[model samples]
Target: MDIATIDRRRLIGWGALLPLAALAGCAAGPGGYSLDEGVRRLLTLSTQRAFGRLLQPGGFYEDQLARISPPDAIGAGGPGRLNAIFGAFLRSEAVRRRVSLALNDVAGRAAQRAAPYVLESIRGMFTADAVRTLRGGPQAATDLLHQRIGGHVVEVMVPELAGLLRSDLLSALSAAAAEQTGIDYLELGRTVAEQAADGIFRVIGREEAAIRADPAATRDPVLIALLRR
Candidate 1:
């Protein structure tokens, strides 16, 4: 057979076997444990743990990696003379600290409200490539998940985060800042949501990497089997 014909035959063979391979991967372990189940469990555990940490008071504020800082425009010059004055005002150390605290607080509260939406996204987005994902790099699962659903998570989070920003304890400060700097709070919400999602995924990726490095630490047979090198 010519090269094209040979390639076509190989494609046909793999296509025919794909379903059986998927079924076997899904029902391979003891008690009918499946790659799907293992992946879901891992994702659930990681998400829950990440959210749990974020839900704590000052969680985002206390963690350097997770903390939300003031928007750059607040420090950098904006469109006009009024913006420059407001930027100067906000650049003061004390005022900037308060703004940073407020942002982090809003992020933490938003995270509390966002957990369900995130979990729902995960449930909806996971595909049938669990085996390859598990066998890939430490962040393979997290990378895949974020690739598929990060934008969705951020989209869902923006409005909720905006609402929280409006109602948070620092609402007055946020309002003044928004008004003076000509920064739209809704845009601020989007920024916070994006950073919040980044922190969440960072935690989840760490958990996944740890589990892959030491599958026995999970103490879950399904994960151990599937993630074991």
Candidate 2:
């Protein structure tokens, strides 16, 4: 079953049942749930929800905020005449759309593979400042998560995205662009991977903000309890 589909009541009951001793190192907040655990749980839920949306077809392609565009350098040529000629071809809307679609496809798959790494990072996250994180802005937890592991997650995704970009399917799509502009597929892969990682965090941050604004709407007792404090 999808983690996003898990019943809220079950999660609430489970959280309520957790022994305080199990969370010994962390400081407890209201209703026996540690602020650290609360922050962790919130980040976990946000990450899961972000991945759930991103794993879908057209997740990146259709999302205006998440969609990958052709590199700006493609349209910005240097002083050389030869560079100007190549830049014009690379700037074509058709070329940009084709490149973006390929990048989005690769980003979706790379994200699928990177999900485990992201979750592992979240699980190992240090919540030494949980109270400050919880009390800060809506995206405070997400900002902290990114500061801690964003680069690592992007690194984990790079090779996977690069591999996909080199696959037969993408290679076929890239052939025309390559012949016309000598586009560097490897660098493109890295750019898309980084952008994809950013998009994932952006979605997670949005979820964090929404949840904070109305924790009761989530119906998760742990979140509600944490917010109350």
Candidate 3:
């Protein structure tokens, strides 16, 4: 099923989404092209919106997509450093504000860019029984959410923010290590997002290569043969 087809309204019932609205206008542009610039804008908006949702009342409390409430397998010192990392990452004063703004932007301006691609990511989400791509551990799933949606957001939003604030975020990311306080949610997110982005590019490359190598394999071979005649 398509991500868009997933009961977005039902998400509200999950009681984890809060009352958020998407921003922007329209899903695509001329010839349905999702220009890089447009995609960047939408990515920014969508990520911010997701961030806001995490902050909303019970926002990141229980939603499967963004849950951070740790797992039993990670009880206390049993997991050692891994357990502490999630805690440090979770303490995000900077993320609290920026993420909140971004989430709202996404809710309001969902279509201003390319909904199909985002939706594609959500929909393609293991529409089959696949192995867990990575061990997110406790709240790793929500971390996945951030990764899937963060960078495009950074690409668009970092430019809009003051240089100082941008520096702070970069700083926060850098200082994520030695997170003696708790899990470095921001850093954790960066790692996940980076990995996801890599996968996305790989898929795109493979598809492009396949299409170039055998147009017929990627298209309706019967139709292509008839056209050749």
Winning candidate number (TM-score): 2
Clashes of 2: 0
Computed on alpha carbons, the lDDT of every model, listed in order, comes to: 0.67, 0.71, 0.34
> Rank by TM-score, descending?
2, 1, 3
- The C-alpha RMSD of each candidate to the native structure, in angstroms, is 13.6, 4.9, 16.4
- TM-scores of all candidate predictions against the true structure: 0.78, 0.81, 0.26
Give a tens-digit lDDT track for model 3, residues 1-229: 5343343433323323221222234332233422222233222233334433433444333334433322212212335664465344436766444433333323222222222334344432321111131111322333454466646733432222323222343454344442333433343333333333333333333333333344355353321232221
Worst 10 residues of 2 by lDDT: 73-82
In model 1, what are the clashing residue pairs, if there are any?
none
13: Cα error in model 3, Å:
27
lDDT by residue for model 2 over 107-194, one digit each (tens)? 8878876776766676666687899999999899999998888888788888887678766324634555445554555666788888
Instruction: Please identify which of the two predictions, 1 or 2, would achieve the higher TM-score against the true structure.
Output: 2
